[model samples]
Target: MNHQSVDVNTAQSFVPKVSVVIPIYNGEADLPDLLSCLLSQTYPKEQVEYLLVDNNSSDRTLSILQTTAENSPITIRPLSENNIQSSYAARNTGIKAATGEIIAFTDADCRPQPQWLNTLIQPFINPEVVIVAGEILALPGTSLLEKFADKQETLSQKHTLAHKFCPYGQTANLAIRQHIFTKSGLFRPYLTTGGDADICWRILKANLGKLEFADDAIVQHRHRVTIKELSSQWRRYGRSNRYLHELHGIELTREIKTKEYIYILLRWLLKEVPKISIQNIIGQASFADLFNTPLGLFTSRERSLGQKKAQLPENAKVIEWF
Candidate 1:
């Protein structure tokens, strides 16, 4: 409950008014840099309200949050019960408690640029835009696996930015109107992964408003350095995808297909496994990214078919994805 307000007189005046919500889960190592980036924003301290929602972290995350709150103007709220295990639930908690009209979200592991907040909120000047998704750059690491993962992420971001039909948004760098969540409900609590995509899908389905991509709104995503960490992360991502498909009525999309899945398996057998094995590498690693195309396609198709089959009868209670 430690609350301290920053003196704004000494800071810049052109602070674009916005509230930044960062959901923390065992992010003790990443907090200092993340908070330093926030405190260094071009935006004025008084115009911004920082919210840190601790998602029942077992580490020193809460202690860091408390320490940060005492010195900064950030509001730190510890969840009463960690009943909701997902980060999406933690974000929803922050969304419910946020006071600013323009709500910005980022991961505790992200370090945003100085102009990140300013640029993210710039698109809001046009009344037609409701959501603004920022660019996420991966932080530098020495590991080859880290580079590969980052490259994949960069390519995905570029693809999303290039396509008008792509409405996918990441929690790492996304902002939305406060009222959207208030009137439409927040993110789905059940989704442990892809909750950002699920939330964006719901927003688009409801025709809530237009979504814009902000290239200037940059946040550096700190990726895991080892193959073991990456494999576990991807597996969790896959499980989350399954949960999202089951909980939401939406499908993955047509780009992912069955043949692609086969190609992935073949590639792993022919290329990746041989390379790793020849090097005497023995770890739980993945060449999953090589198969993501087909996997995504198959998952999307399965989800679509499932949704079609699950269609409820008239007068039945409609399940809310959020």
Candidate 2:
């Protein structure tokens, strides 16, 4: 669907300089830190409008939001019904209500640096640029697992930057023109996972324009601890990949084929099992280095393909694969 272009000058005149939309789930514990960081931004308060969308979180998240709004200069909007619970849905809600020409996005668990907003909006000086993605730094933690997750996230960012075709945005630290959402028809609601990637895919397909990587727009993310948490995260990512496949005619890469995935998993077990059993060995090699990363890529392709396939009805005479 084609998006109606808003007159840049007129929109800018009516709206604030930038509208920062944060979608909150059950994240009461992290609200204070996130708000503190936002309040301390070096950017002028009058130039930026902070909008918080609460996704009907059942915890103290709403109460905290209300209290924080009283002390801070942020606007808090609570959803009437929790019908749509995902972050993507929540963000879409925020976009519809935002008044800024430049719509900035960040997660509730992320704390942006003082220069974050300034850096994120700088690229928008060029009207052609529609999307701006920034760097995500993991906060220091005592747990080794947490530190490992941080390192992995950093590596992922670097890899994402290295790829030109795969240039994407993370909600944790991203900004885009308000018209993009208005024109692009928001994110894919059915995709419970990899919604960020799905949105990026659509943006690129629309030929909306270039996506800029602003390294100076930095935000600190809190890493999840424990292997169980990591595994669950990755699995959900896999399922999301399936959704993507259903929407777009794409599948997993050759590296992420089922056989290769299992092979790498077994290889990691064989290599690390003995080391883990040793008396003095504390750190065993992890298979994530081999399978998980590639698996994610494969899963993304598969999800894209699956999504496309499902969209076609029976006897539709869709193009057949060789």
Task: For model 2, state the Cα shift of residue 228 in Å.
Answer: 2.0
Q: Which whole-number lDDT from 0 to 100 does residue 273 have in model 2?
A: 47
- The whole-model C-alpha lDDT of candidate 2 against the native structure comes to 0.66
lDDT of 1 by residue, 26-125 (tens): 8888878988888788766677888888888899888777776777664444432276676777787777777788989998888899998877877766
Global Cα lDDT for candidate 1:
0.67
Among these predicted structures, which one has the highest TM-score? Answer: 2
Candidate 2, residues 1-322, lDDT tens digits: the string is: 1123446665344433788888888888888898889888876677777778888798888777777777666454443226666777677777777778888999898989998887777777667789888888888776755655664664245555454446577788888888787556676543456667667767878898778888777888876676556555655655544555556655643234567667765765686445545523444544333334444444344444443333322222121111
* Alpha-carbon TM-score of each model against the true structure: 0.72, 0.74
Off by over 4 Å in 1: 1-16, 73-81, 154-156, 159-166, 247-322
Clashes per model (N, Cα, C within 3 A) = 4, 20
